[model samples]
Target: MAQWNPSEEYIENTRLYKWMQKLGYSEYDLFHQQSINDVEWFWRRVEKELGIPWLNHYDRVLDVEKGIQWPKWYVNGKLNAYELALGQWAKDPIMTQKEALIWEGEDGEVRRYTFSSLATEVNKVAAGLKKLDVKRGDVVALYMPMIPETIMALMAVSKIGAIFTPVFSGYGQEAIATRIAASRAKLVITVDSSQRKGKEIMLKDELDKALLNCPEVESVVVVRRTKTKAVQLKEKHIAWEELLSHQPCLEIEPMNSDEPLMLLYTSGTTGKPKGTVHTHSGFPIKAGFDAGICMDLKRQDTLFWYTDMGWMMGPFLVYGGWVNGATIMLYEGSPDFPNADRLWQLIDRYHISHLGISPTLIRSLMRHGDNWLTQKLSSLRVIASTGEPWNDDAWYWLFEKVGKEKIPIFNYTGGTEIAGGILGNVLVRPIKVSMFNAALPGMSAYVADCWGNQMENQVGELVLTKPWVGMTNGFWEQPKRYLKTYWSRWPNMWIHGDWAITDEDGYWKITGRSDDIINVAGKRVGPSEVETILASHHYVHEAGAIGIPDHRKGDALICFAVLQESIEMTNTVKETLLDFLSVKLGKSLRPNDIHFISDLPKTKNGKVMRRLIKNAYLHLKLGDISSIENPNVLDEIAQLKRPGQKNL
Candidate 1:
């Protein structure tokens, strides 16, 4: 039986259909092939079709003479990303339509802003930034919670051609200081205080603490979201309302196609982070392209992803939704807050069409029972997943329980460097359990063995053969580091460092991070493979797998898992889990350590810090864990007894 065959209504309504008709292509595969095969043709046609507004046309389609790493996009073109985002909606329809951006705070406060109102606020904030001496090419640090002001700050920074550097709201003083110092942020924007889980967090205090280490910061813009007066105001403090009231100027400036729009520092395990630079033409365009094509986002839809301002999805949501003239929703707290059904309530209230989440969240939410997902999600046309690869049990739960087996579970994998998705599920095809239907359009992706040979029906490294607009120009002032990180792995191909496999039917699935692969007694296994089996049990909520050094085998597998809130670890439960693991993963490869812990350390975004767990298990000093949501969770693993480690 077909799992999710596209109906005629679905097919005709897709943006893919409109493109096919316009380009004279009969099939989706052919269109995808052309998108990567002839970049000049695909991009030129897409730019015109999507109505991307440009102040000046490009002199050439692309120039790769320098190398693929420095490939130029929209060569010689002069345009601002915001203008392109509001392109055809520059005036009438957006204002007349009513819905645009909606915000929900953890305190039960709701606010709705139409396109006209949002545009005015954006212009006002941009004007305010200019008054603070934040001009073109200035680097500003955006450190705030997932408040509505954060969104405004992003546009304001982009409006004047300044490069915005974002830090996760959960970061401590050390994490915040390191990023500001690395980016050399000239101006900083933060809130006075904010509430999370009913506690007011003094962000101004945190900012002041971070500033003590970095003398480069000249001024600070504080938003009084919580109206806290716990700390005295410094001379550099500027109130959000006072500055924007004057409205210096709303004029948009033209930027070079290759100029840096943002300097995002991807989290590192040691030392300072490597800043990934994104251009005005590159990041926004790719987000719009993938959002419109792969996710099938329409202007009438509201897209919401559970994420933070520091993560790539934050900017992806703004640029992607706006570029396509769609409504975007912002939520300020945990999805499971207030109740387990918080995520469902947001969907029902906003009439969200495209719902995006992580498998990790789904795994946690599943313990709440399927009754929480009974909300009338008729408006939800697409359900998407990202971050980590989905375990089979979690994937099926999302498919059958939430989607009612009707909506497609669109899973895709990409990183900050790509700007958007590389491999993703599409609407025009049938999606299988725990698999993606295709590589996103304009991305030439394939699974290759260690020697770089393309593999069939086997697991290997995922590589991209062709470049797209979204690929980062290079790391900020670290061209050598950039080359070593991606380009050095394969001669010219972009090594994405994901272990992936393809089935005989051509469906693809990412097993795990290539570096996270575990080898037990010569036979290799992905952590996802073992973690899925453990999570499939009724008692387990979430699991993380790591490779450990062994005497006989090259490496051994060690698993850490969280038990369901209601279930306690007993001798019987342990024996049951051990027996199940032996059966599913084979006796030879069964984990030596299956420690049931209280929680797992994860980034602000929902990826488990497996490397941190490994370091903790081996009694190594845990490095800067400031970005982790639960930093102390590592102590659970640190207390475990390792073969050669002392009991602290």
Candidate 2:
């Protein structure tokens, strides 16, 4: 890792130093110290400084006696998140006519919408929802792609005090049906189809299949994206254009600041997904603040984040960028579409200031070499990464190629539950390879062992000791499950299930998941699910699955199976296993490779030694093997390797 001396010029010109000085902070004081000592004062100051509108003010800013389970924020305030994001800005001359959304398709088509224009569309949509008998607190499902209409639908749902659930367009019909049924959504917003990598996907067809299972869905609004001929609408189905054409653009509705605004589902390993609830005031405020300071986004910046509406990053990008009055560049296509340089071309042509990506995408680009990045992106200022832990190779390549060793790569790590990042790199900090410089202000995070003991410079589970404003209120309709998953592990602390270790220099590195979970290409999966599918095969007796660290994907799934005595393992068998698993567990969950073993290592209690298998495959140092009853099984498996094998 290369370290550069702090430049006085950079320090003076940085966004953090300038904001701190403007906000009446002394130059010698640290941000974290000031924020911790006056937590309420800090948030109250942010609410006022950011010009957030409130219909009524609260007597108290924060009440902590509830132990994060019941954080009484803005005790008496009345305001709607929609009013703050669009209405308040609609009244201001500085932002009314400014371009709020810039939509670019893979086929080189583009569309632009101003704040006033978007507000009109949102108002009409809100009116249409009301006409359809949708009431406050009703759940609305958004099954659209990454387009401007998606943002309008979200704002419309919030305007009417209805909670919105945005599902990813890439999901299959079964996945979509499960979420819609769980949410009990009354209305669904979708498009006819979307183009990805020059191929058309029938989004409306999938929505129809999902709606068949969701009888509660009374109305369906379709947005026409492609010129696919004609389909007669059902009794409850309506064209989006028809709804907006007759309705009048009206004023924004005001509600309590703490009112529920959206429900986003977290991909759980077992059982159904948990619906995480977020409020309007806290989410946008926190997202905007973090975007401005941590990401160093400015008014003149053009920001781009590659994500789907189903993911939290989708809403985060909109709220964070638009609140700062920055131009948000969006694309509804694959990064490698048309050619490998498609993303680079957009950055070059649009002169994007801040570019956000995932480590998996960067590694794929690195394999093609850095020729696309040879051209100087003079307007580029910051590069951000999230979704999964970054590797040393990808981090170094970003700094060298995309940044030309000039711009800093801000690494952010957080979840959908919290609207903002807990740990992020700041502009003032020195850039180290694949590590967060420090935890965000007003957040207290530390690594703890299994017994709830805090440890330094050792691998442990990441836990949060205090509650932050951006934390989710609770899981919708599953408060007990939420408590069991997060707070039950440690009292009043959030156990994030991630294995992390902090160095003496205060840089945090993520090792892997504490639970037996797998992250393949930034998608979360459970080992048990894959193992269950493998065991169903006729030739497989028993199987164990584990994730191995890979440079391309953050991790790759590796399966070890003890075949039945009647079957003989061969190339044909390997091919058959691959095909079966791909169909059963989806392509993303398919194992990278399969290994055949005669006997599985187990303890006297009959617990399989999954750790030993992972260690042997990666050639890493075995941590503890005394618990294994037959450790010799590992040696036998290691010796029965095929030709050209370097390590087991």
Q: What is the per-residue lDDT of model 1 for residues 265-313, given as tens digits with 9 covering 90 to 100?
A: 7743222466889998989888888888668897768999877777788
10 residues in a row with least lDDT, candidate 1: 265-274
Off by over 4 Å in 2: 1-6, 22-29, 229-235, 526-546, 558-648
Q: Which parts of model 1 are misplaced by more than 4 Å?
A: 86-90, 93-97, 228-231, 268-271, 516-648
Error of 2 at 17 (Å): 1.7
What tens-digit string does per-residue lDDT give for candidate 2 at 116-227? 8888888988888788777889999999889888988898888888889998787656567777888989999899898887888888887887678899898899888886
lDDT of each: 0.80, 0.79
What is the lDDT for 461 in model 2?
Answer: 93
